[model samples]
Target chain A: MHVMIIGAVGMLGKKLASVIAKTRQCNGQSVTRLTLVDIAVAETPENPAFPIESLAFDLSHTDTAPLLTKRRPDIIFHLAAIVSGEAENDFEKGYAINLDGTRHLFEAIRRERDRNGNAADYRPRVVFTSSIAVFGGPYPDTISDTFFRTPQTSYGTQKAIGELLLEDYTRRGFMDGVGLRLPTICIRPGLPNKAASGFFSSILREPLVGQPATLPVEDTVRHWHASPRAAVRFLLHAGTMDSSRLGHRRTLNMPGLSATVAEQVEALRTVAGNDAIALIRREPNPDIAAIIAAWPQDFTADRATDLGFRAERSFEDIIAVHIEDELGATSA
Target chain B: MHVMIIGAVGMLGKKLASVIAKTRQCNGQSVTRLTLVDIAVAETPENPAFPIESLAFDLSHTDTAPLLTKRRPDIIFHLAAIVSGEAENDFEKGYAINLDGTRHLFEAIRRERDRNGNAADYRPRVVFTSSIAVFGGPYPDTISDTFFRTPQTSYGTQKAIGELLLEDYTRRGFMDGVGLRLPTICIRPGLPNKAASGFFSSILREPLVGQPATLPVEDTVRHWHASPRAAVRFLLHAGTMDSSRLGHRRTLNMPGLSATVAEQVEALRTVAGNDAIALIRREPNPDIAAIIAAWPQDFTADRATDLGFRAERSFEDIIAVHIEDELGATSA
Candidate 1:
């Protein structure tokens, strides 16, 4: 099977690539070839078991989608997006990459499928990474599987639009698509970024490394999260799962661990003791607090759970996964 | 107030234009000018009204939106779209006219609003007509305000996307917008068309006019509906209502009456007597039945009701509305 991964340089994309390379298969089929595409060419996964082609291409360019789609990979993992903060800060660029780029890919796939007037042969499984941000606040305590999406931010809006397009395209038989509304990846393996929600990860990731980290909101503030491993697992599951099981709603709210800031801290303390907990400085910024306040704290995620998607049961398990995966250790 | 109607040649658009002309005002502001736009120029309404400009323009064109927005009408009623059947049959044309066309208009408005970045002026009230088609079944008995949009058709998908864009643009302060999810308009005045739902209107309309009409589905099949006059009222209400009152969710499930086809026939019998009902023919088409079966049956419509948008309380009242509006009579 030929598998294509867009946004192959991003953290999750990179991890997913390495895992696929190690496994040498996708959806129970041998990976004959792997295509990695991004704005910058990704480094080839070390000692890959399949022929790997890394391509540097901007999806926002009108020609990029068609060029990439012509190869007709058996499975396409579309993980590219402008992060929420950047999208909000730069509207045009955000829409260009997040909206137009995604649309172009879908349209390109349709065109390729119908290249010959009578030929409707090419149909690939498109696994798109949507986000929990597609929802906004004035949310129920635990958002149900069927809650309406009223995104407060432009990034969220773009993702919501992408979900709609994915469903429509899939329904029209242009592609077999699955949209995973992924929760924020906690214990993200890197230095803290400027995203309002970055603290959710940094506070844990930094402390695990014996470094000081900042906490921007009250301990009572709750948010949804999943480990990077679980997110990648979701992509794999979506890629392999029967499209008929998805029914008419192509998007699924991925199962996640919902915890308050204090719960996250407690989990860290359980894993790394008081020294790591003490490293978290309580310097609350009200602007970030207000932004986080409007975010969804929890979701039922019943549909995904029923469809055999799973997440870490507890925050401690989440921290453990991070340590095992990122630190290459069993314990923090 | 300068009012512009993008689909001024359509049935509801023409009625809205005539009503506005007769009132000589909108939102308590005197009507100074009226701009009617469509694929073909609309005929001018009768005298004693504001200066009227009817323009022939296709919104799908890249330049048309910018040209239309240059004038900056105070209230822009965007009621343009490709019908569901056409959209289903011609996928590319559907996306081109419905999706791209809507995006261009919104983008044009944004550009027009930000022409002078420092000025932060030119925010117009954009009232968009969405539809109940945004919902598909496997539905609840009564779809609530918060039900997720899982559009089964391309046209519905396009409208759902438009709603998302409307909310985002409004939230960003690019424009003040309102999206009304209009129910099926019943007792339509014109001759029966090829639409699957056409019988919902023709059953009553044709019989009332002493002509035979076909009923394609079972009498037990329920559906939501509003009068054309009520649809126009919803538009005007959306255009003039305080933006702040809409809060974060700019789109509304417009108030409508939910009734079974049997109830419609009973209402027709009550109003026009058995002589009119005798003209009804039962055809029982499986194709049309399957199509109607998947449509939304009812809605709570609490939000729109609370917002002061009103609709006919009964199917009889709906028929009365048609009689008064089209037949030039107080009663059937």
Candidate 2:
């Protein structure tokens, strides 16, 4: 079996690649070939069980999709996207990369299937990483899987469009697709980027590492979260799960721990004591607060739960997962 | 004020143009110029109070959208699309016209806004005609505004994508847009097309005109509907309604009458007597029956109703409107 990971240079992409490299398989089949692609040249993981090929790929260009599909990887993990803040700031760039690029990639697969006489048997498993941002405010307390997607940001709109295309493509038998609407990754293992939700991770991640962090929103501001480990697990599970279980809808809201800012702080206190809690400074930024206000706070991801997907049970577990995975420590 | 109507050569477009021409206004504002565009040369409506121009415009071509937007019509009624059956048969053609074409038109508007220094105040009122096909089966008895859109057909997917784009563009302040998810237009004036839902109109229309019509499904098959006249009214209202009322969501489930085939037949009998009803024949085509079975049966269009948009109250009223408008009489 062969597998391809788009956006392989990003933090999650890199982590996913390392995991797949170590296992040498996905869902049980031996992965003999691994293709890692991103905007910048991706590094081939050292001494994987199978052959690894790294390539620079940009989906915004029309010709890039065809080149990427030429290998006809058995499974494709599409994680590439413009971050939310940037997507909102630059409308054209966001749609060009997020919307058009995804559409072109789907079309490329369709064309490839038709080009060969084996269109009847050409179907690849597509695991797409969507976000909870697909739901806007004026929402219910616990958003159900069947709730409408009224994205307030351009990035969310792009993802929503991608979800629609994915379902239609899957229905037409061009691909076997499953989209996981991921929650914000708690303790993202990287330096802060331009996303407004960066503070969610920074407040916890920075303090745990003995650094100062700012809290932009109130202690009561709640949001959904999962660790990097859980996100990777979701992708692998989606790739192998029975598409028949999903029926006509190709996407499901991923299960995650919904915690308020105070709960996260309390969890931090339980792990690292008063010293770590002191590192969190309340530097209120109204702009960031306003953006967070419109975001989804909680969800009843019943569909995904029933489908065998799991997540951390508590904020403490989430923090511990971050420490164990990122800091290489079993306990704080 | 100036107005532009895409797909102006079709039935609804022709009726809309004639209405606007007769009134010389839309939303209480005088229409000084009218631009009618379609894949074929649109026939110019004669003796209008305003100046009218007809042109052959195919949106599938990249250059056509920009050219159409050059005039910067204050109101744009975007109703162009390939019907369901054709889109299902030809995948590439559907995406080209429905997806890419819509995107290019929105882009053209954005570019025009930025071209001059008046970007802040150049937002046009875009009234887009979406369809109830955006909602697939596994639906509640009465689908609400908050139900998720899980389109089962290629046409539905295209329209769903269009709705997402329209909302994003409006949110970005590129344009003031309102998308109306119109139910199937009943008692359609023209000849039957390739649409699977064509029978919904044909069964009612043909018998009213003293011609035989076939029913492809059981009498219990329920579906949502509104008259073509009501559809035109909805578009006109959307063109003028205050965008402030819509909040962040740009689309609404349009108000429509929910009736079963039995109810439709009963209404037909009331309008044209048992003699006309005898013209109807039961010829079950399993292919069409399976297609219609997956469609939405009813909707609670509360949002549209609260916003002051109205439709025919009953199936009898719908039949009456068709008779008065098309047959030039209150009854056959």
**TM-scores, in order shown?**
0.98, 0.98
Is model 2 an incorrect, acceptable, medium or high docking prediction? Answer: high
Which regions in candidate 2 have their CA more than 4 angstroms from the true location?
none
Candidate 1 residue lDDT tens string, A1-332? 88999999999889888888888877466788999999999999676777999999999999999998899998999999999989999999999999999999999999999886745789999999999889987889999988988899999999999999999999989899999999999879988988898999999999888999999899999999999999988888888888799888999999999999999999999999999999999999999999999899999999999998999899999999998999989974
Please give the RMSD of candidate 1 to the true structure. 1.3
Task: Indicate the residue-level lDDT of A16 in model 1.
Answer: 85
Q: Output the worst ten-in-a-row residue range by lDDT, candidate 1 chain B.
A: B112-121
lDDT of 1 at B104: 96
> What's the i-RMS for candidate 2 in angstroms?
0.6
lDDT of 2 by residue, B1-332 (tens): 99999989888898898889888888688889999999998888667677899889789898888898888899999999988887889988998888888888998998888887777867899988898888887888889898888899899999999999999899888999999999889988878765778888988889988999888899999989999999999999998888799988889999999999999999998888999899989998899899888889888999999998899888899999988999889864
Q: Which CAPRI level is candidate 1?
A: high
Chain A TM-score of prediction number 2: 0.98
Q: Candidate 2 — which pairs collide?
A: none
Worst 10-residue lDDT window for candidate 2 chain A reads A113-122
Error of 1 at B153 (Å): 0.3
